[model samples]
Target chain A: MCELLGMSANVPTDICFSFTGLMQRGGNTGPHRDGWGITFYEGKGFRNFKDPNPSCDSKIAELVQNYPIKSCAVISHIRQANRGAVNLENTHPFTRELWGRYWTFAHNGQLCDYQDLVTGRHRPVGQTDSELSFCWLLKQMEDKYPQPPQDMASVFKFIAQCCDKLREKGVFNMLLSDGEYVMTYCTNHLYWITRRAPFGKASLIDEDVEINFQEETTPNDVVSVIATQPLTDNEEWHRMKPGEFGLFHCGELADGNADQLIDVPFAEKKVKCQAPTEPLE
Target chain B: MCELLGMSANVPTDICFSFTGLMQRGGNTGPHRDGWGITFYEGKGFRNFKDPNPSCDSKIAELVQNYPIKSCAVISHIRQANRGAVNLENTHPFTRELWGRYWTFAHNGQLCDYQDLVTGRHRPVGQTDSELSFCWLLKQMEDKYPQPPQDMASVFKFIAQCCDKLREKGVFNMLLSDGEYVMTYCTNHLYWITRRAPFGKASLIDEDVEINFQEETTPNDVVSVIATQPLTDNEEWHRMKPGEFGLFHCGELADGNADQLIDVPFAEKKVKCQAPTEPLE
Candidate 1:
C-alpha cells in the first residue's frame, strides 16, 4: 500500500504547503519510502517530477517542495512498492495521452491478479500493477468512446463500474485527472477538505509548519485537497466513506452528495461532465 | 527550431558535464530561450525533467546541472518555439510507450504541412509538428509490426524510410531512442562524436568550462554524443550529411558507415537492431 495526494483549485494554486507535510511520511513520519511522484497541471499542460529515492532525502523532492508550481489540478503519490521493484519506471503518478488530453493517475492500494484486465490502445511500460490498471482503465475508455463524449456523466458511470469491479479484487482507492477534472474513488481511507472565502490558519500534522489561508489568497479563491490521510490536524477534513466516488471541478464537488451510487438507466445518465458555466469543446 | 542533445554510452555515465554546456545555449549563448527538457534512460527505466521556463535561469535546470543522474542513454532539447505556443505542453523530448518500451523523441527542426501525416493508435497531446511527426512515425511502426519485431535492422530501415518521407515536408533533424538504441536523422544540422579509451581534455564553446576526461572516465568506457552542433570546441565532431540516418548502440555506430543509405529490397533487410551481445527479449 501507498499514499495519495491531490488538489483542485478555482485559480492556479500551489501544493507546497500540503506537499511539505506529505514528504515527512516518506520515511520520516511513516514508512512509504520506496519512491514518490507528483504531477501539476497548468491549463492543458502539466509537469511531473518523480524519484525512486526516498522523498525525505531526495533532491528532486526538495526542489518540488520549494518550487510553487501553480496548477488547477494536481495528483501525487508515495509508493512502498509491493508488486513492482523500486525503479523509476514503476514510480507512481503515471500519465498517458487520451482524447488529445493528458490523463494522470495515482493508486494507493494493491490488487491481486490484475493481469486479467486486458489492455488494447494503452499499455504499461512499467511492471507495477498500478500502471497496468491505469492502462486497463484508459483502454476501456478509448474502446467505449473513440472521441471525447458529450455526456460526461455516462463516462463517470463507466469509470465507477470499472472501479467497482476492480475493488472486488482488493483495495482500490485512486486519484485520476485529465487536467480539468479530478475523479477520486475511495475503497478505504480517503479524506478531502475544501477551503473557500472563510479560509483560516491550519497546522500540518506531520510537519511543524502553519499557514494562514487569508494571507495566501483572495476571498474569491477556492481550493480543495484530497489525501489518503489528513495533512492538517486543525482543519475539518471530510472523511469519505468506502465505495464512494467523487468528482471535483474547480475546487468544488460536481456531484451534490457523493455518498450514494444510484442505479439508473444507461440512457438517463446524460449529465454533462463539464461545468455548466463553461462551454463544451 | 531547437537545439537537440543525445547520449549513448556502454556504461551508465553522468551527463552533467555535457549538459552544463548545452543548457548555456538555452538562453545565455543562443536564441533557444523558450523551454527545455531531457529524458534519461536507466536500463529499461527512464526519468524526464521538463520546464517551460528558460533553461539558463530555471531552478529545475539548475538542479539538473548540479545533480548527476547517471544513465546509459539520454535525449534532450532546448526549444525556440516557432510553430507552437511557449508552454509546458509544447516542450520537447516527448515520450510514449510502445512494445512495452518507452520511445523518446526530440526534434530540432520544423516541418510544414505536418498535419497531413495522419496518426492512429498514437496521437499528439501537444500542438507541435515535432510531436505530430513522432506520433505519425510510431503509428507507422505499430501498423508495420504490432509487437517487437525480431529483425530490428528492418525496423530501422522502416524508420529511415519514414524519415525520408518526412524530410520532404521541411527540415526534419531528429533524435529518437527506445532506451537501448539512439537513432539520429539529419536534414539540416547534426553532429556526433564517440570518445573511448584514449580520453582527452575538452573545453566548452558556450560556457567557460573545461574537463579532462582522463580524470573522469575509465579506459573501457565508450560514450557517444549527438547534438545539433559540436558542444565542445576542442573535440573533432563528424557532421552528418543531409538525408542521412544513423543508428547507434552501446556508444558505437551500429551501421558501420552512416554516410550512405542504399535502397534495398524490403525482404533483404535482415540486420538485427540490438547490440550483438544483448539477447533479444
Candidate 2:
C-alpha cells in the first residue's frame, strides 16, 4: 500500500518535521519505493513536486523537506505501484481544478473494478487506479453542485457517500482538499493528531529526531496532521476506524455536525473484503 | 512584463543549461523578481514547481537547476507582477486540464480589458490577466471541439485566431503546450532556436556558463528552445514578429503545413498599442 500524509492548519505552517519522518518510510524504513509526490496549498494557490524516483534518494524531495513552505493545507503520498506503471505519470497526489479552486487528492489503498467508474470533465492523466478514483469523485461532486454549494455540510455528506461507494470496491483510504477544507475517509489504516496550545515534545517513530511543538507554534496556532501511520510515537494520534470520515477546517474538526459526519460506518473495522490488491496483505 | 522560456525536443531532454541562464534573469540579471514557475511534461504527466520567492535566491529553483529532470516539453516563466499581486496564486505557467491533457501556459505581456473574455468550464484560480486569457482560450477550444480534433492543423488555426484576438487587447506573447505540441504566439518579443547535429559551443547571456552541445546530445536529437529573449548569446535565434504564431512538434516546426502555419500576422512589428499595464515601458 501507498502512504498518505496531510496537514490542515489555522495559520500557514510547514510540514518539514512530519515530512522528514515520512520520507524515511518511502524507502529506508518501508517499501513504498515506486514514487512520491506532495502538494502545498498556499490559500487558493498551490504547488506540487513529484519525482518518479524513491523519496529516500530524491533531490526534489530533499528540497521540499528543507524548504519550509508555509501552507494551510498539504497532501503528500509515497506510492507502491500496483495498477499503474512506475512512471512520473503514475505518481500520487494528483490535482484538478474544480469550482475555480484546485482540488488535490492522494489515495493510500487500492481499488478493484474501478474502470467502470465513469468520469465527466475531470479525467485521469495517469493510469493509476488512485487517479481514476479521484477523477470519478470530482465528476460526482461537479454533477451534484454545478458550483460550490451554499451549504458545505451537504458537500461533506455527499463526499462521504461517494467514498462509501468507492470503499465497497476495495481499500479506499483517501485524503482530499480544496485549499480551504480537508476531508479524510478511511477504509483501513489512517490516523490524525491535532496540536494546539500546551503542546509538548514529540519524537519521530521512524527516525531519531525529536521536536518541541511549543517552540514551533504560537499559543493560538492549531495544526492537524493525518497520515497512514503515526509519524510521532509520543503524540496521541486518533486511530480512525474503517468506514470513518472526517472534515477538518482551520486545523480543528469542523464544529457543526462533525459528530454526525465523523462516524459513517459503511464497513466494520478489520473486515476482510475480497481484494488481492491490498499491498499490506 | 515577464520572461517566458519553453523547450520542445524529439527526445526527453533536460533544460538545466537554459534554465540556469534564465534563473539568473529572475533577480540578478534582470528585473523579473516577483515570482517564478516551471512545468515539465513527461508524456501526459507533468510536475510544476512554483515559488513566490525570487528565482535567483530560491532553493527550489536551485534544486531544479541541479536536478536534470528530462522532458520533451517544458514551459517556464518569471514574473514582474503588473496586473496581479506578487503572490503564489498569480505566478505564471498556469495549468488546466483540457481533453484529458494538462495544458500549460505562460504569458510575458499584459492584457487590457480582459475581464470580458467569458470562460466556460475552465476557470482561473489565480487573479491575473494571463490566467484569464488561458482559461478563456481553453473554453474557446473546448467549445470548438468537444473531443481532440482529428485534424490538429485546424486546431492550430483556431488557436492562432484566438491569439490574434487577444493581441488586439494588448501585448500577448505566450507559450502554450498540451504535452505534445508547443504553440507560441508573439506580439512584442519572442525568439526560438533549434539545434541538432553539427552542434557547437554556446555561451549564456545572463550567467558565466558555456556548454558544448556535442557532448550532451546525440545526432538524432532535435531540440528547440523558445524564450522572451535569446538565452545564448552565441546562437542565432529567429526573432518572431508581431502577431506571428508557430507550432512546434518533436523539436521541429511540424512539416506538411508548417510554412503556411508559421506566419499569421495581425499586428505591426513596431506598433506600440495602448497597454498602460506594460511593465517594461
Candidate 3:
C-alpha cells in the first residue's frame, strides 16, 4: 500500500504546509519510502516532480519543499514497492493527455487480476498495477464519451461505478484530476478537510509546525486537502467510508452524491477474495 | 522564434554544462525571455521542468542548473512568443506518451495558417503553433502506425516527410525524441556537435563558464548536443541545411541519409507561399 495527498483551492495555493507533514511519512515517520511524486495543476497547464529516492532525503524533494508553487489542483503520492520495481518509471502520480486536457492519477492499493482490464488508446509507460488501472479507466472514459459531456454529473457517476468495480479486486484508494476538478475514491483509509473563512491555526501531526490559515489566505478563499491520514491534529478531518467517492471543483464538493456516502461492505471480503501479492509491511 | 537545445549520450550524462549556456540565452544574452522548459529521460521514464518566467531569473531554472540530473536524452527550449500569450500553457518542450514511451518536442520556428491542420486523437493544450504542429505530427504517426514500427528507417522517412509538409507552412526547425532516438529537423538555424573520447575544453558563448571535458568524462562516453545556434564558440558544430533531418541513437547518427543533407528548394518558396502571421523580430 502507498500514501496519497491531494489539494484543491479556489485561489492559487501552495501545498508546502501539508506537504511537509507528508514528506516526513515518506521515510521518517512511515514506511512508504520506495518513491514519491507530486503534480501541480496551474490553469490548463501542469507540471510534475518525481524521484525514485525517498522523499525525506531526495534533493529534488528538498527543492520542492522550499519552492512555493501555487496551483488550484495538486496530487501527491509516496510509494512502497509491491507490484513494480523501485525505479523512476514506477514512481507514482502518473499523467496522460485526454480530450486536450492533461489527466493525472495516483493509486494506493494493489489490484488483483488488473491486467484483464482492456486498454484502448492510453497505455501504461510503467509496469505497475496502478498505471495499468489508470490507463484502463481513461480508455473507458474515452470510449464512453468521445467528447466531454456538457454535464459533469454523468462523468462523476460513471467514474464512481468504475471505482466500485475496482474495489472488488482490492483496495482502490485513488486521487485523480484533469486540471479542472479533483476526484477521490476511498476504499480503506482516506480523510479530507476543508478550510474556509474564519479559519484558525492548525498544528501538524508529524512535524512541529503551526500555520494560521487566516493570515495566509483571503476571506473568499476556500481550500480543501485530502490525504491518507490527517496531516493536522487540531483540524476536524472527515474520514470517508468504504466505497465512497467524492468530486471537488475549485475546493468545493461538486457531486450530488457528496453527502450520500456509500458504505459498501466489501472491504474484508475483497481482501479475502484476492490473494495478497506481497504481505503488507 | 524560439531557441532549442537537446542532448543524447551513450551513457547517462548531465547537460548542466550546456544547459548553463542555454539558460544565459533565455533572458540574459538573448531575446527569448518569455518562458523555458526542459525534459530529461531516465531509461523508460522522464520528467520535465517548466516555468512561464524567464529562465535567467527563474528559481527553478537556477536549481536545474545547479542540480545534475543525469539522463540519456534531453530536450529544452526557451520561448520568444509569437502566436501565443506568454504563459505557462504556452511553454515549449511539450510531452505526450505514445506506445508506452514518452515523446518530447520543442520547436524553434513559427508556422503560418497552422490551425487548419486537422488533429486526430492528440490535441494541443496550449494555443501555440509549435504545440499544434507537434500534436499534428504525433497524431499523424499514431494514425499511420498503430504499433511501433519494426523497422525504424521507414518511420524516419515518414517523419521526414511530415517535417517537409510542416516546413511548407513556414520555418519548422524542431527537436524531438521518443526515449530511443533523438530526431532533429532543421528548416532554418540548427547546429549539432558530438564529443567523444580525447575530449578537450569547451567555453560557453553566452556565459563566461568553461568546462574541461577530459577531466570529467570516461573514455567510453559519447555525447551529442544540439541547439538552435552553436552553444560553444570553439567547438566545431555542424550547421544543418533547410530540409536536413538527422536521427541520433546512443549518441551516434543512426539514419543513413544523415550525410545526404537534402537541401530542398522549399525554403525560398515556402517563405513566399504562406503569409507571415507575425513579423520576424
Candidate 4:
C-alpha cells in the first residue's frame, strides 16, 4: 500500500543519497505515488517537507533530491492509495507533542474494526486509519500516565505493553520517535541496516545510483536506516518476525536486550515495504 | 505538499498523546490527505507503517490513535499531491541502502531541472523530484568515496556542503538517516521543541484535543520533537530560515551553532513546501 524509511544514529549524517534512491519507487520504478513527506532533526530543531506529487516528478522533491539534509534521526513516507483518495490531508507521517517534546509517527499496516479505537479525547483530523491510530495512541499515553515516565526502563515497559495490546488487533508494524530515540514494531514485513565506520558503496534498488560513505564520513560516525522493504538489493536487510518490536537510540538498540527477537529465515532478510491493507495471501 | 512530525528524548516515553494531536491533521483537520506513514525507532531497528489511504479515516490510523507506541525518536508525514499520480508508489517516505546501511528519507518542497539529477545508474521508481533528489545524493556519495566515510567530521562537512549547494537552487528541506545518525536541511518552514520533566498541557492546532505531558512523564526524560509546523498553538516553535541547513544527532542540532540567526518576523518564516516550483514572496 505504501513505503516507509527511517534512520537513527550515534553521529550526524546526511540521507540524501539513500532518500533519492527510494523516491524513485513513487511512480518511477514502483507504484507508491499517492504522496510523500520527510523530517530532519537538528539540535532541538528540525526541517520538514511534503508533496502530494509522485517522487519521480515533484519539483519540491527534486530540490530535496539535490540537497543533503543531515541528522541523527530521520523518517519519511510515500503513499499508494488503497482506502482513501490522494490529497494533502491524507499523506503519511503524522506528528504530535507530549511531555514538552514532539513525537513523530508512521505506520504501514491495516486493521479490522479500527473505528472502535477512535476516541473523542483525541480526534482525527483526516479520515485515514493511520492518523486515527496516532490519536488513539496519544489517548492511551495520557490515560496510562498523567506525567512522563520516571526512567527509560519504565517508559519502555509501558510502551511494550501498549504495542503488545495493539498487535493483538491486527498488523501493527509501525515507528515512533521523540527525536532522541526511535521505537519500531513489525507485525508483517519490516527490514533494517546499520552503518558505522568503514562505510562502502551501496547501490539503490529503486534507482541505479550508489554512494560510498567511507569517503564522506569519519570513524566516529554510526548511522542506521530502516524501511518497509529492502532499499538495496546487495545489502543485508533483516526482516522482523510476524510479531516483533525494537527501539533505536543513537544508532543502537535502546531496549538494551529487553525486547525479545525471534530467529527468522535468512531468506526473509530481504527487505521490502509493507501494505497498510491486509495482504490477500 | 506533505507534513512531517518527529520526536526525540533522553528517556523512553510513549508518543501516543502527541501522535494523536498530529494525526488529526492527517485528513480530519488539515489538508494533507493523500496518504499517511510513520516510523518508530524501537531499539536497533524501526517499526514503520505506510497507508495508501487517508490517515484520517484509515482503520490502521484509528488503531494508531489508540495505540501508544513508545519511542525516543519518531518521524511521521501527511501528503498533498504535486507530482506523481495518486497511487501507492508516489508516497512521501522512501527508504534505500547506502554504505551497507538502510537509509530512510522524506521530502516536502519541489525543484526545477531535477530530471538532470536522475541518473541511469540510479533510476527512479516514482515520478517526483523527491525520489530523484535521493538518487542524486546517493550518486554524490558514491562518486566522492569508494566506501563509507572513516571520519565523522569529514562526512558531516561534505553533507553540509551538498545541502548548501542544493539550497541555492530552491527549497531543499529534508530529513534522512542511516539508523546511526540523522541529517536535515531547511530551505523553508521547520521547527522543533524539547520536552523535559516539567511537561505541560498542549493542544493540537487542527483538532480539539489536549494533553498534559507533565501528568504522563517523569523528570528524567528529555524528549525532542521536530516538524514543518508547530502542531500545537500554545507552545513556542523555532522556525528555520531560508537557505539555512543543518543536522540532528542525539535529538539535537548537529551543529552547536549551525545557523546564524537574523532578526526576522513570522511573515518571512513561512516557506511553503513548493520552494523550487514557487519563489519566496
The 10 consecutive residues of candidate 4 chain A with the worst lDDT sum are A272-281
Per-residue C-alpha lDDT of model 1 across residues B1-281, encoded as one tens digit per residue: 79999998877777898899999988889888899999988667678888887899888888889887877789999999998887788898998888878899999888988889999867787789999999999999999998778666678778988999999999999999999789999998999999997899999999989989889788978889999999999889999989888887778776633333333332343222222232111
lDDT string, candidate 2, A1-57, tens digits: 899999988777889999999999988998988889999887588889887778987
Error of 3 at A175 (Å): 0.6
- Contacts from the true interface found in each model, as a fraction, amount to 0.38, 0.56, 0.56, 0.00
First chain TM-score for all predictions: 0.91, 0.90, 0.90, 0.87
What's the count of clashing pairs in each model shown? 0, 0, 0, 262
Question: Candidate 3, residues B12-90: lDDT per residue as tens digits?
Answer: 7889999999988877899888999999887688878998778888888887898888877899999999989877778
Candidate 1 ranges with C-alpha deviation above 4 Å: A256-281, B256-281
Once fitted onto the true fold, the runs of candidate 4 whose alpha carbons sit more than 4 angstroms away are A256-281, B1-281
**If both were scored by TM-score, which would come out higher, candidate 2 or candidate 4?**
2
TM-score of each: 0.91, 0.91, 0.91, 0.48
Q: Per-residue lDDT for A1-281 in model 1, tens only?
A: 89999998877787999999999999899899899999988756778888777898888889889877778899999989999898778998999888778899999999998889998857788898899999999988988998778656567767877888888878999999988778999999899999998889999999999999999888977889999999999989998888888888788766624333333332343222222222111
Q: What is the DockQ of candidate 3?
A: 0.31
Off by over 4 Å in 2: A255-281, B255-281
Which portions of model 3 show Cα errors greater than 4 Å?
A: A256-281, B256-281
Tens-digit lDDT track of model 2 for B1-281: 99999998878888999999999988899998899999988868888988877999887898889878788889999999899887778998899887778899999898899999998888888899999999999998989999866566678778888999999999999999988788999998999999999989999999999999999888977899999999999989999889888887778765323456435342222122111121110
CAPRI-wise, candidate 3 is: acceptable
What is the iRMS for every candidate structure? 8.6, 11.6, 12.5, 18.6
Identify the candidate with maximal DockQ: 2
Q: What are the DockQ scores of the candidates, in order?
A: 0.32, 0.33, 0.31, 0.02
Error of 3 at B230 (Å): 0.5
